[model samples]
Target chain A: MKSRVIEIVNKTGLHTRPGNLFVKEAKQFESEIWVKKGEEQFNAKSLLKLMKVGVSRGDKIEIICEGPDEDKALDSLCELIASLEE
Target chain B: MNLKDYLFEYNTISLQAEANSWQSAVKLGTDLLVEAGTVEPRYYDAIIESTLKLGPYYILAPGMAMPHARPEGGVIRTGYSLVTLKTPVAFGDVDNDPIDILITMAAKDTETQNKSAIVQVVSLLDSEERVQWLKTAKNQEDLKRIFESLTDFE
Candidate 1:
């Protein structure tokens, strides 16, 4: 299991649209990815779970990747969160 | 397609509950469905479950929440209900805090088309000014004006 904490840089946070995008992207990988804010942890592939976390702009969140391609999943997700705009 | 026909004014709501979480918002939405006669009292659980499982994602953009479930999950018909939160609730990480507007949508099919009326109504919600006006609407007449404006779009 590999995990890293990343700060949300998207101005609108990870709302429906971006959350959908993230979920869509996460499903591409064979590894299992999860995201957490504080005590709340949710499946990165579930749009509903992602929105439930209510990630907002400037909030710090932790991404956990566990699977065969853990490293690639972590790096890709971190990149996505870091590059989100509007 | 006219939204005024499907839009019902539900004044009976508990604006006090902090819908800051997904569970609360689904509860509020289910209550409205029961009030609208669209679902049986027992269906409340189903609505909540589906929302958590499938979700009514908070695409509210600002201060609105469009809570919806897939069509096959016991959606008897296509209907809409509006619920106003007294203190607003947060849906995960959306920027709009305390969602004041709750638009509950239930369709017969997930990929159903010819939803021009509903689409028009949803499009209006994208406008910040309209959403603000909806927040302050005092009565059904006031609410009607909002839907009435959709005629221009048609």
Candidate 2:
């Protein structure tokens, strides 16, 4: 398994559009991707689950990936999180 | 209060309703709220004006929408009304377009409006399976059963 803890940098954080984008990114991987906010973890591919995380700006979240292509999944997702803009 | 409580109290579910446009669909929900005395008639106009400015930001997902303005938009009380369209209506949102479910909400204050009402409704409609079940629901009992099952709503 591979994981990375990243801070939400986007002004709006993950809601509608960004949440949808993040879910789209996660679905391209074969790994089982999950996002952890505090102790709560949700399936990264589910848009509603991602929104339910309520990731506001400056909040730290962990992206965990296991199974085939975990490393690539981790890198791609971290970059997506990092690239999130207003 | 939770969605189930608001829904039951208001008795505000209109299933298989016809709407020629997004605004009309929203009107269906607000009309019920007006009749229930949850919000003033001006509240409906406020919602329409906000949507015109913000686009369809309320389209929560592919098939659902939750239309609302700020509390000061003319809220008399905090309440919600739901309208499920017989045919989907497009609100020009590329992703969450062709909305079939419209849920209008009025809150006494912005702080209370920012609470878990939207989240709880999203939880109820999160899955495609649940959304499909809701779309196929034939009566108020079916809708009530679904809302009642979510006891953990906060």
Candidate 3:
């Protein structure tokens, strides 16, 4: 598995629109991806679960990816999280 | 304020309507908000304008869309309106297009209240079973019961 910890820098954080975009990006990879905040973890493809996690700006999140595309998934998702705006 | 409180106070449920486009579908919900005095006439224009600017970023799922704009768009108070369409309309969203449910929300530039309302609505929309139940429910009382029952899920 490959993983990285990133901060949510977007003003709204991982709420409705950002969460939806995250899930959409996560769905593009075949790797099993999970997002973790504090003690809770959720499947990165599930928008509802991501929203339920209630991550906010400045909150740190850990993304873990496993499978054939783990490294690529980790890299892409890290960039996505870092670049999230609006 | 709570979901039930807002619904009861505003009677903001409109069912089985036809909309020619996504903008009109949103109009169904914004109309209720306008009626409740939660927002001014321009709030509807803001929502449509933003939709044009932002794409259908508000389309939350396959058949549900939460139409809203920032508080500065003439929000008189924090309120919400639920509009269930008789026919689903496409919003050019790839993942969550052909929306049949429009829930318009307004807030007064406050974070906590807006967050609570969004969270509550997201929870309610998360359940496919519940959303389907909502789409098919017979009357306003049914909608009231469904909204009230959200307390149990919490």
Candidate 4:
């Protein structure tokens, strides 16, 4: 498994539109991606679970990817979160 | 404020409602919010406009959706409207389509109050059995009982 901790750059974090984009990006990878915020960790590919976490701006999250493409998945998801715009 | 409190106070739930299409289904839910004064008429327009730009952003599952516009889209206060359609309508979302339950939410801003609604609603529908039972709510009293019976996200 590969993991990276990063701060949410978008003003709205991963809520709504940004959240949708995050899920869409996660689905493209063959690796299993999970987002961890504090005590809660949710499937990065599922929008409902992601929205349930209600990630906000300035929040720090850990992205974990495990599978054949774990390394690529981790880098891509982290970059996506860091580059997200409100 | 709690979700049940807002629902009871605003009286914004419509069960077994009718809508010919996805847009109308959204209108049905947003109209209830408008009547309750939780959001202005423009809020509905904003939802439609946003949907046009972005696909339905709140299709939680195959049979349910929790639609809401951004807070800047004329939200008067944080509130929610529940509308269950008599006939399910497709929202062009191939993954989660033919939605029958609409939990339309309006937030004045991204405060704890609005976030509470998201957590509460997600908590209320935690199970497939729960979602099926929610579709069985035929009246306000039934919904009240259902809401009271919910134990999660307290």
Q: What docking grade does candidate 4 earn?
A: medium
Candidate 2 chain A lowest-lDDT run of ten: A12-21
lDDT for each residue of candidate 3 in B1-154, tens digit (9 for 90 to 100) = 7655786689888888889998788888888889999999899899888778767767777888888888899899888888888889999988877888887888787475336767767777888878987898767888777766765565
Candidate 1: give the TM-score of chain A.
0.94
Q: Which stretches of candidate 4 lie over 4 Å from their true place?
A: B112-114
TM-score of chain B of each: 0.73, 0.91, 0.92, 0.93
Mind giving the per-residue lDDT tens digits that candidate 1 earns over B74-98? 5666666676666666665434455
Per-residue lDDT of model 1, residues A17-80, tens digit only: 5676677678778998999899989788865456544677778999999999999989988898
Q: Model 4 clash pairs?
A: none
Candidate 3 residues A38-68, lDDT tens each? Answer: 9999899877677666878889999999999
Native-referenced DockQ of model 1? 0.06
Question: Candidate 4, residues B2-67: lDDT per residue as tens digits?
Answer: 677888898988999999999999999899999998999999999999899888877776788888
Error of 3 at A46 (Å): 2.3
The prediction achieving the highest lDDT against the true structure is 4
| Candidate 3 Cα deviation (angstroms), residue B5 | 2.2
Docking class of 2: acceptable
Model 1 chain B poorest ten-residue lDDT run: B110-119
Task: Give the share of true interchain contacts found in each model.
Answer: 0.06, 0.23, 0.35, 0.42
State residue A5's C-alpha deviation in candidate 2, in Å.
4.9
- The lDDT of model 4 is 0.84
Clashes of 3: 0
